[model samples]
Target: MEYTSRHTDGKRINTRSARRPCFLPGRIEGYGTKLQRDIDGKKTWNDFFFHVVAPPAMLDHGVWPDSPTGYRAANEEYCGHMMRLTRALFEHLSLGLGLEKGAMAEAFGGDELVFLQKINFYPPCPQPELTLGVAPHTDMSTLTVLVPNEVQGLQVFRDGHWYDVKHVPDALIVHIGDQIEASMNELEPN
Candidate 1:
């Protein structure tokens, strides 16, 4: 079967139309389907992307593809590893803030925490300068851990300019999300 991206209405998603809510449980999102355009109606870098969202419960239940040889085993292993790493990172960050080691974890729903992983794929663009792979925006999760490909297209806005993020082998780049930033502000409100 062809693995094509389709919308909840059974319509194929493309780069032309605006985003709509995806009601299908395990649907793959099409390019630019989950992003808003700029003031000039220009699509973000998301136009070159497609992704699958897998919730923790879904992963636990093995609701993943199994026919692609070792794909199932590899995905499960990766998910388990990422979850452990997330837990460790939370504990360290909590301790660094002078709170109890499990404070962050507890605040984030603890053992029953719902983790969502988005596996994004960005294809090659004909005119790379015209569109972005993903728009510049802060992540909405409690924390985001990104394992980027070796293409080196990731950039970070700093000091009034965007800087390329260097890729390190076997390294994961973590970002504190809006929720954590809000919590930090509450901890030390100016």
Candidate 2:
């Protein structure tokens, strides 16, 4: 997409060199070059994962027109598409569960739902066997729509094995996150 391509378009800010502060949900972090995961006080993972988070308001307010890479227009366009898709998916899911069309959307706060855009960039690793690009973990969001590039590295742990996710052109993968799993558990009978 245009948003992803803008990273190399020379007009976008170089997040690695800019050293800007990123405010995550629970913690604040400084921009860094390498990707490291502290597993019980030991640093692991030899990979490069760069990400940019855009708040919901940014979707409404366009990015600066002449500022470097023109990421604002691209990001804004992508976010709008995602928002509509997510809403439609929620509606279909609610119907599948034998509920009204807007039931799931209503539970998620309707028009006030907060949507944040996160773009992750993972570069090549020298010793691929020695480290992981992203540590194995469940997603924390209510839902996640992933659009991976041609180089496929995504995997899912299932049936006691890690299975590679085959890449499909022009396809989007939707993952049910922890929130949905928790809600399903609560709905289960004793």
- Give me the candidate number with maximum TM-score: 2
Give the number of the best model, judged by lDDT.
1
**Model 1 spans > 4 angstroms off:** 1-42, 45-63, 66-69, 185-190
Residues 75-100, candidate 2: write the lDDT tens digits: 66887899899999988888888777
The whole-model C-alpha lDDT of candidate 1 against the native structure comes to 0.63
What's the C-alpha lDDT at position 174 in model 2?
A: 94
For model 1, name the residue pairs that clash.
Answer: 45-132, 45-133
User: Model 2: how far is 124 from its true place, Å?
Assistant: 3.1
Q: What's the true lDDT of residue 189 in model 2? A: 24
Error of 1 at 84 (Å): 0.7
Query: How do the residues 112-181 of candidate 1 rate in per-residue lDDT, one tens digit apiece?
Result: 7767666565544445666666767888888999987788778888899999999999888999998888
